[model samples]
Target: MSRLAVAGARHVVTVDPDDTVLHDTTVVVEDGTIVEVRPASAGPVDADEVLDGTGRLLLPGLVNVHTHLPMTLLRGLAEDVDLQGFLTRVWAAEAAVMDPPTVQLGATLGALESLLGGCTTQLDMYFHHDAAHRGALAAGSRHVTGPVFLDGPGPDGLTWQAREELLRAWPAQLAALGGPQVPVAALPHATYTCSPERLAQVAATLREVAGDRPALLSTHVSENAAENADVAARYGRTPTEVLADAGWLTGDLPVVVGHGVHLSDSDRGRLAAAGASVAHCPGSNQKLASGALHWEAVRESGVRLGIGTDGCSSSNDLDMWQAIRQAALLARLTSGRPDAASAHEVLRAATLGGAEALGLGDVVGSVEVGKRADLVLVDLEQPHLTPVHDVHALLVFAAGRADVTDVVVDGEVVVRGSRSTRVDTPALLARARDRAAAAGAAAEAS
Candidate 1:
């Protein structure tokens, strides 16, 4: 086990409500867990490596609670298409051409991009998710994967059996990788894509496989107006209500809903009662012209909120900084109040809230003793982040991905000077370029 220490930080935002910020601090990590967080004046402890965080802001690594990482291969491919067109004409078509190798390469590129941009963890849902998990591990990033479950045939006619096989195979793979923290879960793509019976079966399987173990269950719910209307028309209830009927929205299951653009008040109540979280993909929603999620309502109803970039195909990037800013701006716009969403709230949404949504709060969210040592150091000496009045404000508004100086996950430094430690960036970019061209050709043919 490698022991590491980050010392002499100007400020450390712990994100713990009781102890929000630690000034002039040193955080010590041993064997992947945080060992001590003391004043810088306390002197150094034993460690193999040390990170000088002078003139930097140390905080918990940003968590992206929802994303389709493999869609990095499809970034900018459907730029002009609306949500429906993007889904049917571009996304579906491109997915057909994604074999295991292509999917793994795309996911590896996406993980590298995310790590370089200061995201240490992501909750990803997509097809070929075993490859995604492997890519995440190789990139030295923490990820919780929920393989997509559809009622009918998927791209390449993949059936539930394939998804089941992946799920069964991933646990041992993750264990072998020495990443026991990564959990594999079931993701019914959406209320529209999965039949009611199929959804219930997924819930049942998840319950069986994850018994007494904390697990995540995620899906897209009530994303578009048409989806809400369709669910209402079919089941005489909203999508949330239908999901509740199918045993999806229960207290025992740790559920996270993606998008959630058109949730009804009743749906919000149900989510609140069930302790379900919502992944607010503001960038993707704005880009796709999907209606904005009522952030105030969701928060007020006691739903845990986290920020996500969604998929690169819609959002165009995997930058969590951009997602945080967009989430704050959209919340303020939706509430028609400048003070509706605070900078600190948005920052929390990207970090601690995201960890809570993934049910990894106790282990990875905040910079506290006993938690995993996942941290990001932002260079505060930059022109854009100069004269920081409030650290949270600077992070939520002024800073960009370019301002990220270092990223550490599981006590290992995976990014230094805005570059990935585990991947060959030039090679990954070249492969992605080739795969993107092939994907584009396939979409056009379809």
Candidate 2:
């Protein structure tokens, strides 16, 4: 069996259930599962190869719970706008540019960025899912992706009937095109875009397909005031209430909502009772003037929560470090309490909380033995990270994507020394530039 050891980590932020932190530790991996986590001072480890983790902070790889991965090509295309206007312009651009090849190129670029930034897994909702799967694989990232359901034909020209077929067949399709870690999930865009009938159909399809294993249904809910108003006007209830009434919020299938910025108190109770999680996208919400997540109430209600970057088009970057910091600050500002969301809480939201949001808690959330080794090593020897006192605080407040020196997914070294081992950076850059230019010109012409 293949084995590897990350030896002598200055600190390992295990993000375990107890939030354990280990000093001078070695996390040993066999095949892909973590076999042992012991003190580096104990003894020599028997492994095929050993990676020096001295002066490094090993953390569970960040899980990005909500993203339109291929939207990387649309970054800065729709800026300084609210959700409605942003969607109008961005959808136009996507329609003009989001063919299979453009989608593939954008996904490749996004995946490379995500992996280099220490995000090992993602819950992505976008078009041309086959290309998205391939791109995330090339970066050695675990991913859950499926057809996006909208009321009308989307940029991919997939109709309502076609989307149903795609959603029903998602598991087999992903298996056929499998790589690193393939998990089946459904992503219906949102209540604003999809009707009640559509949501019911999606929920039914998901239930049918998820016979024994759990399936995840990810969607946007209560993202902004306008969404709430629109949803209420259309369905005579808030977005959260509409979802609850439609029977989408249930225990059988896991549901992860993106950007529940305006979820009501009662909505919180419903969500918590149904065992659904929310992916808090502070960066995108703040940028679009949507509103910050009410972390105080959400946490108090006992709902599962995680941080997300949303999509590059709205958030301008897929950097999870920035998302963590943004979430911390926004929680403080919105809650009107300095101690509302601690650095440690925000850090867990970025890692383990995100894993639970993606229904990957048992597989790739923490550095516990028997879990898959999806891990990141941050270079704490950097000038900024020098003299670290509070490790979790420093990680949430000071560290950024640049500090990620190495990333391993499923015990495989995909990033080393600040670069992706699985991607050709220069060639990928050139390809993206060419496609981006073409996409830009197409958008301009449109």
Candidate 3:
């Protein structure tokens, strides 16, 4: 087994059960699990690889609970529009350019972007998730993705029959992708896009195949007032109620919704009771002028809430740092309470809260002995980070993506010295640029 040691971190923000913060700490890793966390007085750690963490803050790798990986190619495609307009314009662009190879390439670019931003794991929903896995392998990031289920002809132009085949074969395909095993999502697009019968069929199939580890079903829910009105008219229920009636909210299979922005009080209670979670993409919601998610209400409802960047197509970036900050700001602003979301709370939302939401809390969320060593180091030598009065405040408010100097996933270094250790950065950028231009040309032609 390989060994790695992170020595002399200025501050180790262990988002542990106790929310502990250790100073001048050393973390030792064996194989891919954390083996020891030591104080400065505990003596040096001996290992095959030593990462000097001095003058830097060490943090558990951030988790992005929701994303559409290949939509990196579609970033800025339909910006400054309402959610509906974004879908209409962006979907057309995606249809024109997102062939198999392009999808894989875009996923690669997105995976790299996520890694650079200090996110180690992501829950992604998109078509051609087989290709998304290929990109994850290249970037060495943990990814949970699966086939998307939508009624009518979907974005990929796959028939309903073809989409079902993709969903049915997802298990074997996901298993074949080598690396640490991750959950598969039975991702339907939304309440409006899927019929009650199709939702029931998906639930039954996934429940049987998944057994003890039920497949986490992800779908967009209660994104905006308009969507809520439509669902209320058609199903005579809130989106949450529509899902609940179809048996999506009950049972062992985890329900991970993309947005719970407009969920009513009863809706939140129902989801909380069913142990479902929400990927709260505050940044995306605010950017699109969608209503703020009632964060305090959701927290009070006992629902598991995690931060998400949604997708680059809508949010235009996969910066978890920005998402974390936005969650804090939005909660305070919308709730009319300055103390509504503390720095520590938002940090937890970005880290352990996100992990638990995805059902991976046991493995990758925090820096604990016997847990997977998904970690990040942020450089503290900068002017902005100097003389930190409060570590959590500085980290949550002042830190940016460029401050991330190194990242490790599963005890292996994937990023070092602010650059990807394994990815060909220039090549990836060139390919993305070339493909994006080609897509733009194709869009104009069509």
Please provide, for model 2 over 1-446, each residue's C-alpha lDDT reduced to its tens digit, 9 standing for 90 to 100.
Answer: 99999999999999998888999999999998999999999988989978889899999999998888898988888878899988887888888878887888788889889999999888888888877878878778887788889999977778899988888787777778866564578888999999988888888888888676657888999999999999888889988887887788777677899999999999999999988999999989999999878898999998998988999989999999999998888888887999999988988888888888777788888999989999999999888998889999999999999999999999999998898888889999888887787666765665
Residue-wise C-alpha lDDT for candidate 3, range 377-407, written one tens digit per residue: 9999999998988999998899989999999
Q: TM-score rank, highest first?
A: 2, 3, 1
Error of 1 at 338 (Å): 1.3
Instruction: Give per-model TM-scores.
Output: 0.97, 0.98, 0.97
lDDT string, candidate 1, 1-446, tens digits = 77898988999989987638878899999988998899999988678988888999999999998898888988877777667777886656556678888888888988888988889999988777777778877898897885688877777478878766655665555566665275557887888888787788888877777656677789988877888887777778887887898998779877899989998888999999999999999988888888899789899999999989998888999999999998899889999999888988889989989998888888888999999988999888988888978888988999888878888998899998788888988988898898788888887776
Per-residue lDDT, model 2, residue 377, is 97
**Candidate 3: deviation at residue 108, Å?**
1.0
Pairs with steric clashes in candidate 1: none
lDDT of 1: 0.84
Instruction: Sort the predicted structures by lDDT, highest score first.
Output: 2, 3, 1
Better of 1 and 3 by lDDT: 3
